[model samples]
Target: MELITNLPVLAAILATFLLAGLVKGVIGLGLPTIAMGLLGMVIAPAEAAALLVLPSLVTNIWQLMDGPKLGPLLRRLAPMQVAVAVGTLLGLWAGLLPGKGGATAGLGAALLAYAAFGLLPLRLPQVPPRAEAWAGPLVGLLTGLVTAATGVFVLPAVPYLQALGLERDRLVQALGISFTVSTLGLAAGLASGGGFGGGALGGSVLALLPALAGMALGGRLRGLVSASTFRRCFFLGLLILGAHLLWQGLH
Candidate 1:
């Protein structure tokens, strides 16, 4: 594949990363989600994920470094993270199936689903702790499958987290930790498959620099927006992106 490193494409990539980072900075968990949603239209899902990996990791590091102090919050969410990681592997396996388009379709569907749910008045029922165990496996599988294309996995968990009444800080922290593991897992899976090298990977890594810069800038501006306003605007953006992806995939 020919890499587009021309000045205009480079500028576009930087702008996209900045938008993604700004969204994440404002919302606490949308850097890759926003970036991949937008970028997947222009690049392969795997490539999009690869590009966002570094930025997601770098941004989340600060979020998670402070997470250790939130003991109860960490304890409650750790299991879900474990489940997402496990499910991601299964998703990857399914993704690798020849011509199945499991990863690509699943990623797009998950994003659409997440965006739609976010826009609606959706809530999850509280299950007993034992039943809660099942959520991890399901989410993991979904995360893995979706990661193959868009490199974003937390969509499956969004509703659950929103319903859990988690404060913004805890939710963001949990997401950061979840993505940290997801990114590492994806790297390992790609390595084993001998994927994501050559110009594509280099381009992705280079793209990550601008993404991080954008996120940093956005994080700085996050305080200016009211929570409710941000929430509304965020969902609207997701809705638009989701519809666009669905159209792209179906056609």
Candidate 2:
């Protein structure tokens, strides 16, 4: 409540969510990516991540629930999720937000990688069933490390899921499942670090309204636009943002 009364912080929170939700609604991903990348510019990465907890969890749950075959998907993804949870805790213990410079630099490098992948057509080799046990844990560990440091988890997680040879819809649902677990794991990490102060908690809850509203608008917009082209523009913008974060961190 007190923080919301501060116009600048409130405005930043609103804009962050509106844009994040719009991205997710259109592309079915990037909510946390945008929120952390943009919000961390104005606030601490830990606080930015903390503010994402509720909305990210809720929206991803919505995504996870849409597909009917959650049971099989859940079973297949269990090891990955467990590894993510454990790895997130370990990464946090290792210094979740290291320092402003270090965190921003790490995030910048990650965003650069993410943006580059966005431009390329990534064709991952299929993971054989026999390899999933080892492969899944490796990807989960990487995702958790990124989430702990950068507040983004798309790197190995999404690409790994993409390589699993699942159908399109199943891939979407699997991403949702992974994101949901990441959100919860992130929340736990933030709580452990005392990032969930009153203002941060309130900002997270209040940001949900704009997030939902933007999602609704974006959903409507999806029908009227070419999403593939839109995604290209989104990636370009992310590239610029990544460059800025890198500059800020290095300087």
Candidate 3:
């Protein structure tokens, strides 16, 4: 729309989507994390988030559709479902807070930092039952908060999942399900907060094309890339994005 018609901004959005899609296609996750980071630089964090919702839905839906072995996926993640939901709600509430520009940037910075550290591939020993009990709620809370604030919920969970050595299929399924649930929650929360007006909603729809194009290309190129390579690219991209965010915030 007119809001994003600036040639430079349009190019940046498309380029962000193209790279984000490729990352997701090859690695099973990273669409929001990458796209939001780049787009956030070009626009408000909320606008970046608005831009991401449809694409996140589209890409995750595609992932959920193709993913098999649902039973195992559910079983492995069952313990945390409630936590995810709860965390998502909390995040929604957080999003509704006033003076959100600073909060959104702060949340984005935290997410970027988490993703950056996760690049080191840290792992905890077999998690204790009590830890597992608490982990879900904590991660869910952070995920939801991130969703509400910046339209991204990959933090903490994405890295934790990777650390757990999840197979590609399970990783994709888990993220897809999580994103779907949380995004719906976010949509509801944003609607309640009077966040998605006519122009923003229109922009959100327009943003979906780049997201879809990115994911489609990623899907096609999936076989050509190694997981580690993709992960490295994702992590490094986050590092750059995170630094950029911090610089933007400081200035």
Report RMSD (Å) for each prediction in the order shown: 2.8, 1.6, 2.8
lDDT of each: 0.67, 0.84, 0.69
Best by lDDT: 2
lDDT of 1 at 225: 72
Task: Please provide, for model 1 over 1-251, each residue's C-alpha lDDT reduced to its tens digit, 9 standing for 90 to 100.
Answer: 25455666566667788788777767777777787777776666666666666777777776676555667766776777666666566656656521235444555676777777767876777545666566655665566555654577566666666555667677677777777777776766665565656665677677677767776776777778787788788878877777777666776
Question: Worst 10-residue stretch by lDDT in candidate 3?
Answer: 95-104
Q: Which residue pairs clash within candidate 3? A: 21-214, 87-140, 87-141, 91-144, 91-145
Models sorted by TM-score, best on top: 2, 1, 3
The TM-score between candidate 3 and the true structure equals: 0.84
Per-model tally of clashing residue pairs = 6, 0, 5
Instruction: Determine the backbone clash count of candidate 3.
Output: 5
In model 2, which regions exceed 4 Å deviation?
1-3, 98-101
Instruction: Score every model by TM-score.
Output: 0.85, 0.94, 0.84
Evaluated at residue 190, the lDDT of candidate 2 is: 77
Give residue 251's lDDT in candidate 2 (0 to 100). 85
Clashes by residue pair, model 1: 21-215, 45-149, 87-140, 87-141, 88-140, 88-144
